[model samples]
Target: SRHAQFAKPHSLWLNDPDSEQDTDEDDSDEVEQIDQDEIFDLIRSISDPEHRSMTLEQLAVVSAPQITFNSKVPDRVTVEFTPTVPHCGMSTFIGLSIRVRLLRSLPERYKIDIRVKPGSHESEHALNKQLNDKERVAAALENPALLEVLEQCLSTAGRST
Candidate 1:
């Protein structure tokens, strides 16, 4: 009975065997659903310069990031981004933020290429490299004593002025 059920084409659908009625209507929704593994994969590709154990997604800088696969370039991913604001000075910061995120999420077998669409902020390609440097900057800023040192320096400079 199991074999017959699987073998019979018409058994699954009683009416309109070849019609579209048997098809699922929510293809777009299905396509939009990113698997848990894929989400983790994408998340690991990012690193936040501002905080340890925090990501761009965690920082709420990234909106919906769409990933598409290509048969020709199985090892390459093209990423597109949208910034929070049109004229924010941090567009470069955010773009770099996303670029770093992608690089960290993917494995060595896969290469990531980032492209920020026109009409969004930060059109330059230089931001990609800048993102890689965020970790260093973030680490420097993380030192609790750095603020006190800076304040003392500022006070000394102010007195000299």
Candidate 2:
């Protein structure tokens, strides 16, 4: 069931020894580095709660270039996103969605910083603080109403992908 959630149709393995099909060599022993595109891929498909037909990518909320990872600070990633409108009431909701997406998709060691792009929202600092606050985020996820909305938005991510 887990595999079905994120699987592509193509198979990577080659059964016939004589076939010239080549598989990329495994480098699992090396440190797994996360990059901007990988982070973007993880959250880009999330649905906008107010706009069910559109994805966060389509609304220009999540951009690959806005995501960054520092190799020097392993297991940490920063993602700054813009709300569709400067005063969009859903800014906090969007931030929460991104936070939840990364928390579920990335490994336990990863420390995610989800923030509103500077000057994009009127309450950028406050929203960023709320989103990054472990206790606040946890509490928000526990609310049945917010959780329902989050689940609805997240459900579309899998189908759209």
Candidate 3:
């Protein structure tokens, strides 16, 4: 039986050597720092919850240009995503998917900040709040139904390019 529901989306691919990118951090022993393209690639293939056949990249919900990290604060990353519609009810789930993807793929030291693009969602502030709140995010994932759906959305992220 495939108990993917409890699995992290990036778990399967994390050990794949081909999936690893060479980073130019301070030293070889230093933790690898990922760039915008790497971040985009990690999430570009995430399957949209509603359009199962389409990816977040294909749906234009997430893009490399929308991902950023300040040079001085390389440990902090901010990803702004746009909902397909201002009233899209799945904004929170979409944000969750991004958060979970980054959380699983990036180094533990990386501070991932997932948010909705300004004016992109009617509840943008609330969405950002939920996504950034560790407690709320944990609570959301604790819900079996949401976790199952999240697993489904993330399962397709390992597609070979």
Candidate 4:
């Protein structure tokens, strides 16, 4: 039931002949424009790291999705996720994957803020702070050399020791 709901298409305007005729062309055009919320929703469909086929929604990692954009402040998006267990080291990696998916899917203008949902073993505030540390994370994300290192590590792990 929940999976069906998440999988449903979010139309720009619900089809109602009467409503469509009542609105001006400009108004209808504005309504069709996709915003950050829509972008986030698309990114949220990305599957969890541990689970191959099932999406984050299916795995129930994602909670409430919020997006804010303002002229005075940088655009910020907050996503809440829960790990399979309290002590999962892969939680941070999963969070980073979600962040990368968001960044790649969204326009570069947005600044993402990802956090683990409260009531978990990990500190939500601390995780949030780590995710928000752009300077440190950006260096790793931007460096091709670092990605190569990560790929090597992954390849090595896949082989018998």
Which one wins on TM-score? 3
Q: Each candidate's TM vs. the true structure?
A: 0.41, 0.77, 0.79, 0.56
lDDT-superior candidate, 1 or 2: 2
Worst 10 residues of 2 by lDDT: 11-20
Best by lDDT: 3
lDDT of 3 by residue, 118-138 (tens): 999888888788789998787
The lDDT, on a scale of 0 to 1, for candidate 4 is 0.49
Give the clashing residue pairs of candidate 1, or none. Answer: 44-104, 44-105, 45-101, 45-104, 45-105, 46-101
Give a tens-digit lDDT track for model 4, residues 5-93. 21213211111111111111111111334465564554445544444445565666664454444447545656667766766544555
Model 1 spans with C-alpha error above 4 angstroms: 1-41, 44-65, 122-161
The order of the candidates by lDDT, greatest first, is 3, 2, 4, 1
Off by over 4 Å in 3: 1-31
Tens-digit lDDT track for model 2 on 23-91? 212122322667777778778888886776789999999999998876698678889999888777677
